[model samples]
Target: MSNPNYDQILVHIIDYVYHTPITSPRAYQRAHIALLDSLGCAVETLAHSAEARAFIGPVVPGTTVPNGFRLPGTLFELDPVKGAFDLGALIRYLDHNDAYPGAEWGHPSDNLGAIIAVADWLSRSQAKDVTMETVLTSQIKAYEIQGIFQMKNAFNKRGLDHTILVKVASTAVIAHLMDLTEDQALSALSHAWQDGHPLRTFRQAPNAGPRKGWAAGDACTRAVHLCLMAKAGQPGAPSVLTTPRWGFYDALFGGEEFMLPRPYGSFVMEYGFFKLVAAEGHGISAIQAAVELAKKLQEAGEKVSDIEKVTIRTQKAGKTIIDKTGPLRNPADRDHCMQYMVAVTLLKGEFIEGEDYADDSPWASDARVDELREKMVVIEDEQFTKDYHDQKVRSGANAIKIELKTGSEVPEVVVEFPIGHPKHPETLGLVKEKFRVNMQKGGFESATVEKMIEMVEKDDLPIHKFINLFAKEVPLKT
Candidate 1:
């Protein structure tokens, strides 16, 4: 095997799968969830925006392939590359895609657009039979590619975006699933290298809106495009991420070489999260811990009005990104603001996905959320901070402590990881359910989704039939 130290993750994963055996019950489970949730997000956002349709809709007739992943609300049966991006953009249009928490932000599940697009397209268009096992295997490999990279690299600090990892991870995984030769996989990596990443404008304010969600899918879509080109004798720029002056590390990453916390494996796939609520950023963990504490206080008969101050101690990442103080201007801002999210959850006993962000949050007029925001002092817990840096860990840990006006303080409720953490019981079950429910709710209810999930899990399903099902028509937007 080639030395991984010198290999980009895209190249390294291809080489690793060649030599090692990788699969598990957990890996298979996560694959199903990743597919379902991503599709659900895609379907939900399909009719909501024109940018989504304008960008992703071309995939259908653009490619010669008739049977491919059927993007909701459109008739495009795209080639794998276009399919990946189309699907990615659809799911991510609202900035609601999944995330991998760290000192620097990482979106682990972003590559799903690429993985599912290729898997869906290949199984449908080509005679290649895709099974649950193959899909699971692909998910695991993709997760490892994205997750392991996020463990050490801080992309945002260098003025780039996290979707760059999506590009690398998706390209390598697609290359592998297509059964590309080792040389071909390396070529795909080169394509990924030359495929430049978008700026971080999508994640920040003023301009910060829904684009952050689909950015990864965009990266993945291009990944499939490059891989197919390489298969057709197209050349790739091998040192795309690491050329001395114009390479990825220097051009985008502040000249810092990509440092991986671990070798590629099924580890990341096992631990990915499904965003139950729409606000998916640095607060997945803190939101859970604080929500739990809020419920406990509410159960104790303490009204939000009686709450004088709320103190939340957590890893610095949660505070730095989501921890905001002021009048939130939009849904994007409200979702990320620590005090606002916690306050809504406490006030209504639930977090509304797309409620009154334009007008005031019902409690928006309530001085209490702000009162809570003011009383809330976000401090970094040393242990939480320490756990966040550990390589073995994926999501940054979070802890919340609340103080009430009644002069009684409950024991601090600290969630080591959010509900979506790999170790958490909810990650697998909730993620898949979230996908199925959201998709059905969005309008593309079909037998194909179940068959697709089954194929991903058991590896014995007839992949062509599944792909053909996507070609079947559904309700069009009126």
Candidate 2:
């Protein structure tokens, strides 16, 4: 195979994925928790609809291997490429996974599809053997690769989905997990860089739908495919980012190279915020602020329907992403709309969950929701936007205010950090509760749930055994 001086970006990613010591026990602990939490998110999505159930499993019916990689919360066992797609899609199905805020916004746990699938498959099929500890280490590295890149690269600004980072990160780490040399890992990552990215159009109005949910999973699947091709001696394009007029820098990135805000480490996974609610990450703080506003209105015996106007003050990212109006096409549209989230919470006096945004839900048909959304005005808060991008103060802040017809107004409720922010003290407890609820919804037995938690707590558990826990057949809605 042809090998040239690799791009510095690929070199940094390869070296870190292969050589990082990951000495932080806390990092590993957090990774273990993230794994369980991702699985919980996967299981929860399994019940969303039978259509979701149809997306996973062996590509062809009755296809079987004695030790194929098992996707969590289902009985599917397949080649790692397809398996990665399945697990990645499931974790991201509800957009409820952990998030990192930066110039670009993305869910870093989206890499787990390739990481877990390849690790577990290697453990079952090869002699070197993999372990949950190994998976956690790779998980940390993947999160760092994706999250660090996310810190300053605004992919959405280029109309690209943030899953490009998912593909790059997954390819780098999965190459390492497959026991490739560092050079091979670099080659694999270069291939990933050369791959085309999906547009963000599917995530915005006029076409927003389920593609946003599966986009990251699709990236993870492609990453695995690229790594495997690299392993098979496929050549990589070393100048994919820098090559003249056709390179990513000039052609796609507006001639700007990626910015590295920090060195890669376990930092992202450790500090990445979990989602307690099922809405888009940008809208979480707004949802929190709206919930608080609803409580005050209740105390005063006021009604949201009587509101003369509603206003939302949010970070620039929130306004760019979730601030929406007009008819929401589907769950994908509703969950990403800041107005929809806050309006629903104000009307119901409760946090919005994944199911609440379903196209057929009562909230979708409620004229009150649309009415409230119509009365809402969303604006960017400069300070909130500044704090959101600040390394030392990474907060997704939002403020909500309502003016009632009676000429009285509820004081604006501002939330600097939602419940799942790393700075929030109760984040861990809330995450565990979120996981428990999802697991129970998946119809997993209490004993099985306890065992899964035990595995995450223990170090160095064999990967095959861990994968086996999720192999039990669960009934799917027909």
Task: State which candidate has the highest lDDT.
Answer: 2
User: What is the lDDT for 111 in model 2?
Assistant: 93
The segments of candidate 2 whose C-alpha lies over 4 angstroms from its true place after superposition are 1-4
**Candidate 1 total steric clashes:** 12
Give the per-residue lDDT of model 2 (tens digit) for 1-478: 2234877777777778777789887788778788889999999988765556877888888787667888888777788888899889999988899998999999999999889888888898874578787888889999998999889989999999999999998998898888787667777888788877899999999899888888988998999998888888887777788888888899999999999978887899889999998989999988988888888998999888779999889999999988888899898899889999998898889898888888778999999999889999999999999999998999999988899999988999889989999999998888888888898888888888889888787667888787788765755654
Q: In angstroms, how far off is 161's CA in candidate 2?
A: 0.9
Model 1, position 354, has a per-residue lDDT of 39
How high a TM-score does candidate 2 get? 0.97
What is the lDDT for 244 in model 1?
85
What's the C-alpha lDDT at position 459 in model 1? Answer: 63
lDDT of 1 by residue, 83-185 (tens): 6777777666654556665545666666767776777667766656766567667667767777777777777777677787778777777777787777777
The local distance difference test score of each candidate is: 0.66, 0.86
